[model samples]
Target: MPASLGLLRALVLLLLLLAFLDPKWPREGRVVYLLDFSPSAREGVFALAERLPREGIFLAFAERVERLPAPTARRLDLGERTDIQRAFLEALKLSPDRVVLVSDGLFPPLAPPFPLDALYVPPKPHVALSLLPPPYPLYGETVGVGVVLEAPRPAEARLRVEGPGGVWTRTLRVEGRKVLPYAFPLEGEAEVWAVAEGPWGRSEARLRLAPADRARALVLGDPALARYLEAQGFQVEEGPFRLPLEADLVAVGLGVLDLPEGAPEALRAYLHRGGGLLFTATPRGLFFGGWDRVLPEDLPLKPLGREGAALVLVLDVSGSMEGEKLSLAVAAALELIGTATPEDRVGVVVFASGHRVLFPPRPMTLQAKKEAQSLLLSLRAGGGTVLGGALREAVDLLKGVPGGRKGILVLTDGQVADDREALLALAAGAGAEVSAIALGQDADAPLLEALARRGGGRFYRAATPKELPRLFLREGQEVFRGGALEGRFPVEKAPHPLTEPFAFPPLEVLLPARAEPWAEVLLRSGERALLALGERGEGRVAALATDLSRSWRDFAGAAPFLGGLARYLAGAGRALALYAYPEGEGVRVVVLGRLEAPRLLAGGKETPLLPAGPGRFEGVARGEGVLLDGKRRIPLSLPLPGEWTPRDGEATLRAMAEATGGRLLSPEEAGRGVRRPLPLRPYLLLAALLLFLLERFLEARVPRGTLREGAPG
Candidate 1:
């Protein structure tokens, strides 16, 4: 209450409030040297880091972060997976006056706290190679092989390709931080090698290809069907019903009734162990033969067969189809007959000046297909092109048939010089799907395309004999699907490992069957699965109801479908790859897929391929042979590691520095060091307490009434 007491309290309050300021004295400066230790950084980065002034503290980072007590020149072994933001946060924790990052700029872009600067270390001079995608592509037609080349400066690169077509090379100049990319389109087996050799250093990379593949198919009990399988690009081998066969696919034409002979059971055993089999019907109706006891009922089959269509083939044996054209046409027809179901009624008509029915429309049994083939082979070519008479005969063959599924296929090499309008009229009156194929350069293509368009069928043309058979089979699909194509049921693709790179070919004839509970249905048409894959014991089995007898006529995705199916059956499902890229002074090899302790082999030596992640293996290759896993051989070569490809991250580092109100510095600019602000709050609090005690002592010494209110400084 006294004046001295009030003044002392005011002074205490003032001292306490000042403690909250906690101010500090400003000094010179201090810096934290943030260094990149990734493999991508220049080889001299470590030595350069050590040469910086002692005024700055050192911090190093790559895929990981660490604070260094002293500068050192060596690898941190912290992989190329850069985390700049994380590294920046760690540098801020050191509480320096400023932080300077010394790096090749390979680290990802980052936004740092207020006190971060960059001492950009340009990337080491080197040329490296890598594939565009980490994985290799499937082989079929022309497939593009992608290449990536990274260089610090303009590099002279040479690319070489060796394959079924032999070897060729090309040279070019590549530059800058952006990768120089190139793609080469190839078909069949191919191996490629690339080299970038110049003043910067010599770097190399190569691509290796698998051997050419052709599936071996076995045909049991029917040589007639053996020829049919060969047309599908398979290597066919006829059999006397033997076991332990060297075949990827097998077709059984015998009735299941002979199961007691052990042949059917043996085939079933083969299927169980991973062999592919088609329990196809012969000329005679397919007889299950009471073999349900030995064969699994889950096998997708159509014992009753499909209701078939009526197809008429009107062939032109005109003078134009005299030599190779006529011979190929006959061969094409022979393959065509095998596509029809036994229930389908098929007829063959030949025309030149006049027309004659070679084979009348009847059930297409095994005997019928053979008989048609024989009849077609014996036919001779002569006279002018006369299509009207052939159309009349074909119409007559389909007269009794319903309009729903009747078909007329007209083949010709010469233009219709006689009765063209009459033939068109006859074809229209038949109320059937009429498809046509015009052969050779002289054939009338417009008329054929128009006929097919009007009749709701696909038109085909074969400028060469090579295209004849495929066109024939594609027409079979229209006839098999019924007159106007009532939209055949769409095939449903199910998720499965076999469905990798999934696609469906245009299916012509699919046997209706049910899948068992354990069976894996990969493809389906309506409720019945068209293709089913399963593993029973030591082998794999596939039930493909879609008739492969139907040839392809440039149907999109069909070739891949067939190729993939054959490869899958032939033990190609395991995805294992070995790839090599430069890593620092060595070559880093990567293997994808499961394996135990895999290794990289080069120049007859082996190096351990260590586990890097789940399903991924990595290691360093010793030399350039690039062979590993006893199978794959990658031609890996590079003068420097691939991690140095993008050159440097100068732009990214500069942006981060500018964002934080910092300047890009050099390794020599390490003088920015000064201790952080010193706290004064503790001293101020102590002073306030001492003042309070002094005020209390004075009040006690002066008696209570003597403490009077007065203005005092």
Candidate 2:
């Protein structure tokens, strides 16, 4: 029985050997050519198809793939939907070893059913920046054609201008992920090219430029300001009486005289005809009333009364200020006070460790003026500087003063130790402009500048005590009064409803030159929607109080939404990261397409992975701990345990998802839809089969060898 079993096993082995040795002419390697025939797919597909090897499978799909030419292996009809998964699965049926997917790399939102090795041939003749007519006219004018060169690190790119004449070359410096703008004068139909040559590769673009008709502007101001305007080549009119209707620029310096009653009507008509008016006030308060009506707010242009000017001087003295520094500050203060009118009420506050009122609100009397001088003479710098306390006290003293125009001039050499925001809030609410003069090298210029901006004032950096007076006097002329608030949207907790009410008092924003205009209503619930408000108008801007997370909430915590409702709003062409997710246990992460980053961020930390590939990343997570990006304090929690809901306080979660045009799905859905683990079962089965063959061979050959050796002995 054992011999018979051995014979049967030998027969089975012989049969397997015969099967392996028999040559039935092995089939040639099959190539499956996937041709995408979407409506937009043009000659690129046909060009790629011609490039493929002659004897291979050709599959075309617009509505379906059919009618194969000779030497083509097979044909398939994938109805309507260009489902890659369905086509891949059908290719698997044909058992093709190689696949060449020739299509515009635009994939429909569908999870691949099976793994497919695809060589994608994307469509060429790519348009980088969409060429559209400039929103503002640029016809027949030497308007600057800014060519933005975007690259990874600082790189050198050649900028070429091809117009009516020919191509002109210029060099450009490109910072990492930045668009370095190079200006070119547009004559006629022109193509601007920015070509970068580096280790990575090359990129180029050709933009069309046309002529623009130059618009005329009439500038009106005092001789000093008119000179500045004339320097900019504006037709300036220095006015005695209001200029004639033809003047495009009207600059009036009402040096203490009431503007003629007809001035407002004429100014209104001038503005209606696209004319500009720049009015500067004089010592007398004549321009205060009528200008207030024409301007958006009255306090923005008011004069710095005696009290406000006096506070500016005292703020210059403190413990940190001693010797020549203190004297210089006093001299600057005296110079500022000398400009004030007797009717102007002045108050003085001295701050060091605490606050003291040197002179309470009083009419600019001879005695008070003498006292102010005496106070300056008697001032001594000894204690630690507490600017916040001094600012609070100064604001308190100026609140009761009866004057439409008011300002606070602050002088400090150091940053405030405490309650800086509180002091800023008080100064803003006091309805008085707060300007600052930084003395010496130790002054916190940035902090002082922020303080000045919050209080609707200007900031000045004075190198020495000698410079303080001049800086203060020059900036004191332009006082920005009234409260304004600024803050960024919460990005950590997003997608969840945000319905909390936040308030920001009205503010006057000095629009930067040629700023790309955009407004966003960012809700606390992590929802931000862009709004279109027409170019340049001034009025009171308010944000309504509503719960953004509520069902019916429209303008909840959204300033832009509220601003849009009234059409009385006063207010980035940059591609930013939108979403990211982890793929499998192999430490790989995937980011949504269209976002370019210098490095990938995960779990609050940045990873050094080049984002130049097709938005997919495969690398070790670097560290043992989880990575995080953006605000770290906001933890991602799964609310309603066992259910995949975002924990409260994740302000940016919703924004991150929405910004990338993605949905904040459940963890289960994300795991199933976005991430797929590598399959180990096939490799394991192959290993098992290999081991079984070895075991069977060893059993058959070992016994036979041993038996043959023993018999010979």
Candidate 3:
């Protein structure tokens, strides 16, 4: 053969030889397709499978292989609902190079099944942002909107607001693939239409403003009286008189004035609207008649005659009153004293830097009257004004004063102090009216007006002390008259059903009404007990007693003491009522009605039985079965096991099965009190075998090759 040709032929032969002994290069790229086979996911899975590459591995979740498509490189059909975590474990065994998840975004939180390089295929109509407050309070109050977005990566969207008002838009920058929060501040009582426009589509929400403030009022007289009705901070306005209108309260003063032209109609309207009216009038027949006509027929006002009532004159002799005011005040005090009855008590308080009680509370005898007159004449104005202190001291002197309606007539001529609230409190404590006589140019009219209102007394302006005498002596009549007998009774401690060692307070008794009363005594440790009072002759005595001066420091005068006494008389008759009871197993089951059965659930089955007596039950339980109509079956093996402890040893026996997972039952559940078979170990062993086979198969197929290897062989 020729050498060159032979060489060429040899080269060809060498190439053929090399081809015969060829080392195949491995295919490095992998294709992994994950299919979801959940009940609602079938259509999506089929669509994904149709679009998937035929040569790639196929994994179907929540369904078996017989239920899925063919032509898969490596097919894995999962039976039952897909466990995302288990699916990931199975996926790692296959060790695919490329991975894809095909389903709706609603998937369980699964461990990473594949590397980060894997591709994820999400289905369409992917809820970009879903607003979730449906059937919400819209257009009436506040509304909340929840936005949910579906995306593999974070999305930035804007919420475009549109409604009857106009268009306003705000941008929402979402960082992760989830729902985001945004709040809308809607003000006033207006309806707002809202729609959230995001990357996907628009979600609608409606917001309606709640009712603003609808509070109405009805004033009996001129709306001017409504102006004075400012205690609860309500806005006052004038309106025609109508009966059935929504007003808080009505004030009728100076009695001569008729209800406005529509006043009768307004009064009817007022009553229908739940209105309360306060009527103030002098004892004059003309004024009283006018005042009586305006009041509701149910509350008739009666007038008491002058001359038999107890009255105390309280005069303020501060430095601002160094002239004519002093003389008038002294005369007023003497005249007021002269009107008092022999049985009526009279006290005088003259205040300058501090208060000086001219005469302590004493009956109106000639000597007492004479002494009071002497004290009034000796009054000297020389110190700084402390009207609040004087008012307080005057009230203190009237403590235990003998009068149904006790009061102090005050005469002041300057802006003494700023303790009006304290004076009001002292007046309330004494339950006494404080009539004020403002004298001179320095007298504060507003302060006097407020003082009169707070003390439930009348305000009069007197230019000098001479006018003060007339003002004080003119209102010498009492509206109500009654004597108070004050005394204290000792209390003892007793056991209470709901509380321990219930202690009572020292109680006062009022005469003429034999009433039983009760009081709530609060202890230092935040516990409370009720103390009852028994009926006494002509009055009622509370079992609990406390010193009026010490325990009830806020209540100082006869009226307040009598009021407390009346309350005690009303509450002592009723016995304590049992509200609830305790039940078995440290469980406090409420006693709904009279329980005729035992309160305990007993026997091997914890059967509920009828109680033989109060809070006690009688029943039997044989085994582990709960009582149906007072009888229950007990599992045979429950009480037999050495490790099992019988809840009721006398009625139950514990037994153990040879199978590792079998549970011992009490004889009652066996029906015939016989032991039964429980096979659990077989299932456990079968599961173990399955796991071992799976591990072996995984070990045999997964990569054992090192990265240094050029290719997989």
Candidate 4:
């Protein structure tokens, strides 16, 4: 049989098969209209309905999906939420051959079951800032709250963060999708409000600020620490030293055992009655003073074991540092050397017209101490002072040694030739700390003070050799007591009443001391205790090996740490909190602490917050007002609803139609019913038949050639 004849027979057989399948042409049939009744889509739905084909079936959906009898002027209230997917899925159940969706396209894109067409309504461009849920904060703390801001373009927005401390207003530039953190100062009462407004949009969130109660404390000897405690929400009264009978805490500064006439008695009574007493550590208090007498015998603190310390002493033997000044400097050096145990390594750097290392860091053994004293006694004052050079040499010597608690103590009676302040600042990052002592009146007090502070060590000033104490020396020249935790170190908090998720400030004073067996260590530096607590009879007692300067007067971060500590001492726990924020079209209220009865008052309506679980409760409310729980009233503002969340919905509509083999329709096309997808089987059958006939004609007309088994044609 010829190939063309065979192809013709095959085409005839395929044509019969195509006819049997019975493919239909494009035509509108059994059409269904899925209408969006959501608030964002309502305007587009009603307007489109007037122009939509009345012959088609109609279904309306928002919170509920249902068939509509007809397009009418009356609007049905099916709640505010828009559910486009639900409406489309229901339309398929009706066996519609074609589905047309009318909406603003504000809902998530949906892939319809049948060929779908869409009439889109676009929403206006909007900007909004939604605050994340806030946490129940402690008194005197800054709550860092996150807010998400969305805008089509950059917006200059004004934000107001209000607390019991007062309202703080901030102006910032905002753009598309940025998460910003705002710190709200929580004061005596926990009620905070954050409001952001701009030309684009305005959003405000209110927190149920129910901060813990303020702690009452009696502070003696240290008003700086007292003031810092106040910033952290402590009611502090500076004193006559007589512990108030109702006081929750008492702090004695400088490790002074010399209590006012009735103080010791009052303190003992206070501790016995379950009050808290904080005692500082000092050499005078431990050796010369009455630390043992003040604290309970059972709560006695032990001195730190012999731990190695890296000591570098810089001395100036200039013409100005002659008789008494030189002697005093040597005496101070000797005292510092005495404090070091056999395990400690000590180095001495002396400068005259030049600087030289008298001795490198070596173990302070019996012979080493003797050799150091002999070298110091033989030193003579001469030439100009090279104080800066001496310090450099000392730091270099310290670097050679390894370990924590490394220090450089400088004894200078004259200013350096270079910028004295810059010279001291240079020592800030050399791995070791730099402390300075001014042996005479001419010494730069400010320069040395700066050096000591930056080095995380001590600065002392002496007018004459007489100012040097006999037994003990402390920072700032006034001495006698050696603090147990007596330097700058990062404090570690243990789980206790005195701790929270608090950002603790840098503490400058801590004595190397251990807590008593009866004491529960609340704070630590390395393995040593920084703050410890014990109880006796009805009273409580605390031992602070640090200088106990929770003073915010200089350090900004001191407030929260000390405030939380003072609050715990005053017998305050985490207080009840009521949180309310805008979610969707309504407000969500959450209760933090266990409350017998919690209620929200908003939009002139009162609603009770139901308990969800242990220490957790929640409910929903509409509009704005205040949340009330017992005597507490926290302001509330519910912002954007979910249906009103920013979205143009145009892309969603186009995508949905394209996904289901449909098209986005204009008002004119929607009125005539949606266009159906053209059938492909008819085109396939016609192309196949025509190609077969063409193939036969080409074969009959064109020249044909045949090749033998091995011959080329």
Q: Please give, for residues 53-82, the per-residue lDDT of candidate 4 as tens digits.
A: 668788888989877877654578777788
The worst-scoring run of ten residues by lDDT in candidate 4 lies at 471-480
**Could you tell which candidate, 1 or 2, scores higher by TM-score?**
1
Ranking by lDDT: 4, 1, 2, 3
Error of 1 at 180 (Å): 8.9
Summing lDDT over every window of 10 consecutive residues in candidate 3, give the lowest-scoring window.
637-646
Question: What is the Cα-based lDDT of residue 212 in candidate 2?
Answer: 30
lDDT of 3 by residue, 481-593 (tens): 33223565443344432124234444453211111223222211112111333322222222111122233333333222222222223212110111111122122222221
Task: List, residue by residue over 1-713, the lDDT tens digit for candidate 1.
Answer: 47667788899999889998776665666677777787657365775855776656777787788877766744577766557778878877776777777887764465677567777776766656654322333333223444666665566766554444455566767674334334432334566665556666676767665434456777655454465445445677876656666576766655443322446567766666456665443322122222221253435433233457888999999887888998888887876676666767889999998889898888888798788878888999999887887887788778876535788898988689765566566656777888889887888898888777776666887889878876775566546642111224467889865566665655555555556566777887777766666665544556555434442234555545654555455442233454556554465777675355666566677777778886578877644554355454444443333455553477777888888787777665644454556578888899999989998888788765455434354
- Which should have the higher lDDT, number 1 or number 3? 1
- Candidate 1: what lDDT? 0.64
Residue 339, candidate 3: Cα error in Å is 1.5
Question: Which candidate leads in lDDT?
Answer: 4
C-alpha displacement of 544 in model 4, angstroms? 10
Best first by TM-score, ranked:
4, 1, 2, 3
Q: How close is candidate 2 to the true structure, as a TM-score?
A: 0.26
